[model samples]
Target: MNRRLPTKTIALLLAAALLTGCGAFSNDNRVDPELSLEQAKQTAMAMELELAEMIPDENVASVDQSQTGVLLSCDDKRGYQWTGGMNIVVQGDLDPAALVDAIIDRYSTQELYTAKSSPTPDGGPGAHVIGQHGAGYLVNQSPDRTAIEILSFSPCFVLPEGTSPRGNF
Candidate 1:
């Protein structure tokens, strides 16, 4: 004769699965509020400068963040229309060539989409990190229908130590 599990066991198993999928069992459920445009820019710049000083570098040349709001047109009323974003760029200095390789190596394991070594007009080695994310299209004209994209590009001589790396979301 075949022996089947009790009804209570099946019910408990289903409940546990549902909780796991819904993230209800997560330890931390807090979400940080969104930052204003000006705040975001300032915070990003400070972080960039901090990173620049950590590595072995002479000085940070420039640190800037760009932000943009865009509205695209779609063929249908519910068609896909994505908003564009701003790009951030940062430049700095380095004495020994090996330090450049070290920074790139660490960044390779981060949230960076693309990292490449390029040349600057002033005869300096420029390293860049680029990332892109789709905000998705809206199905209805909801009040919260805007998407903000943050891009940071800081080529620092020295990177910050003991400081966790952060990027735009």
Candidate 2:
């Protein structure tokens, strides 16, 4: 006697094998969204410290942490009198769309700034706000919906005459 597996069972088995092989359910990139605002601030500070290590020559002028976000300002050692600053905003437990919309609404009302919204790679909402100068603001949620980061860079900062800014990106 000969027996054959059912089509539905075969299909389901194949799908399971494929998914396991592809690691489609992996959470390697997932972040814990349960972090409190203070924890997020500490994370931002840790990031700043990492950046400092990356660019040791730059001097950190100030760091400000608040309920909204953390702001870090640095001086480029070139003596060009330019200030480089970055702001990081962390949003926890809010829907991605609502977070992005709030960021857009907050910046849209400001003068000399242009706000544009786009879809993030993970299907989340993102916004980019540009000021009259070279300053820029970026707001986006993580792929895992763990948190949102809003980054802003100052316009006064610029590379020295001979240095290339391309590497900064």
Tens-place lDDT per residue, model 2, 1-169, is 1122233423333243233321111222122334332443444444334322321122222323222322222233421111122322233334557656765676678775555675554456766655432334445544444434434333323234565333222
- Evaluated against the true structure, the overall lDDT of model 2 is 0.37
Best by TM-score: 2
- Per-model TM-score, in order, reads 0.33, 0.40
Clashing pairs in 1: 54-159, 55-158, 55-159, 90-153
* Residue-level lDDT for 28 in candidate 2: 20
How many backbone overlaps does candidate 2 show?
A: 0
RMSD of 1: 23.2
TM-score of 1: 0.33
Question: Candidate 1's error at 48, in angstroms?
Answer: 1.4
List ranges where model 2 is wrong by over 4 Å: 1-92, 156-169
